[model samples]
Target: MKQFIVELINDRFMIAAVLLFGLGFMNLLLQKNLIKKIIGFNVMDSSIFLFLASQGYINGRIAPIITNGVFDAEVYINPIPSGLVLTGIVVSVSVTAFFLALTVRLYGIYKTVDFDEIMLLINKEAE
Candidate 1:
């Protein structure tokens, strides 16, 4: 148990990622408001990026940039994971913006962003 605790403490980024993902997932699943759901989605997205960035990080290494013709693998951390995380962040932002736009349109038409209320209105319209 002590070893586990020490390991967990050392891997702070993993713990943070898990917490963010869990919180976001709960919010997404349990909330009725569209805005809240969007926020949850953002939280989960950030957690994923955090996890990826953490995977790329090393204790005492710089970025994988060749400086002055000195090329040693040990001096530089792998850059791919960080690059992927950056791409994921950009995509997540765009997706969040799109979702918010849709939510705005829904609110304009229904005057509310509650998920159940929107479903009820749609069902009533259908019948």
Candidate 2:
């Protein structure tokens, strides 16, 4: 137990990110409210971004930007993954906006934002 816990402590940031993403998605699926589910989706998106950013950090490394003009020249950090994560963060922001719009439309159509109610109403309409 001690060894396992010790190992987990070293990688806890990643572990936490994974758990946050999973739990957020699970909540989105298990919840019955449209707004609540979208909030969960946003949480899941953030967890992924956090994971990516945290993974790029090294114990002792200088900034990747050479143009910054301040470095010991002995150590450098990788910039590729961090750039990708920046792009991902932008995408997450766009998706969140889109999801919010969808939620608004959902509210307009059903007059109630609850997923269960929406599903029941859609089912009734289809039949």
CA lDDT, every prediction?
0.94, 0.85
Q: At residue 74, give the lDDT of candidate 1.
A: 83
For 25-121, candidate 1 gives per-residue lDDT tens digits of 9999999999999999999999999999899999899988887686888888979998899899899989999999999999999999999999999
Model 2: ten consecutive residues of lowest lDDT: 67-76
TM-score of each: 0.91, 0.85
The lDDT, on a scale of 0 to 1, for candidate 2 is 0.85
CA deviation > 4 Å runs, candidate 1: 67-69
Which residue pairs show collisions in model 2? Answer: 32-115
> What pairs collide in candidate 1?
none
